[model samples]
Target: MNKFGVLSFLMALISVIVFLILRGPNVNLLLMAIILGSLSLLGIIFAVISKRWLSGIIGVLCNSVVLVSAYFTLLAYGIAG
Candidate 1:
């Protein structure tokens, strides 16, 4: 995985943990899931950009992240469009 991506993952994890701690267990789980899901998107992006084993792993991670992030975005956006 790229250095920046790893850092981003770690940061996301830390932020989620902190948010959960402060926002209550229920909210934390929901938020963490969303964040991880979003970070996983990096994995897919990495896969397309890189051919290394690490890149493949990151791509998977990024895909998950993207899914969750997209979910949340849709949830927030609703069907307003």
Candidate 2:
């Protein structure tokens, strides 16, 4: 794999480890935010490194997921009320 792939793999691994370490009611949400944030950042990096536009499109999709998840979480906690 290339450098970007390696970095993405590392980012994914970090997210998993963080989730495992923070798997509790009081902190799972926070952990999720950190994971999604990292994923979004990595996606952007991947988008920047690719020669094709598809990679950038995927990055935008990943970012949207992160954003939607954040909004969903906020709504779950009645933060939007």
Candidate 3:
């Protein structure tokens, strides 16, 4: 198992929870979520290439959820296109 991949996946999950909980006019949080989601995508790619299926799958799911939620949240706030 790739520890870095696992850690990245966990961080992605935490970011999602934070994003959902802190739903307000916080542009910083939205930016942070976007950064974390991108990093998580990299983590997923690396994990899969390294044969760390569990970490890769988790990262993919968490990152997808966070990115989608972040997009809608930003749209709702009129902060994104």
Candidate 4:
């Protein structure tokens, strides 16, 4: 049970859920994207720093997915690429 990995996994899950639930073109889309990107970035860092391999890898993968998909969604709307 690596603490860093657990924390990273939690952050990744939260970001993914938020991205899915609040997804769409809206006034706060940019802000949400930025915040989610930062959250995923931190998750990636923590995953790299984690001692356990499984949790760390899962955290990194999930966070990566969230980060890329969120940006791509924004890119689709001509927001940020």
True-structure RMSD, every candidate: 6.1, 4.0, 3.5, 2.5
lDDT, candidate 3, 1-81, per-residue tens: 667676666667676666666556655655655665565566556556646667677666766776676666556546553
11-77 per-residue lDDT for model 1 (tens digits): 4465455444545423444455455555555445545555556645654564655566647645644
Where is model 1 more than 4 Å wrong at Cα?
A: 1-27, 57-81
Name the lDDT value of residue 19 in candidate 2: 47
Q: State the lDDT of candidate 2 residue by residue for 6-67, as single tens digits.
A: 45445545544654776566755654665666675775576557545654555455555655
Q: How does model 2 score by TM-score?
A: 0.50
Better TM-score candidate (2, 3): 3
Cα TM-score per model: 0.35, 0.50, 0.57, 0.80
C-alpha lDDT score of every prediction, in listed order: 0.52, 0.57, 0.63, 0.82
Deviation of model 3 at 17, angstroms: 3.7
Instruction: Note the residue pairs that clash in candidate 3.
Output: none
**How would you encode candidate 4's per-residue C-alpha lDDT over 1-81 as one tens digit per residue?**
678988898888889777777766664666777878888999999998996889888988999998997687567657444
Backbone collision count in every prediction? 16, 0, 0, 0
- TM-score (C-alpha) between model 4 and the true structure: 0.80
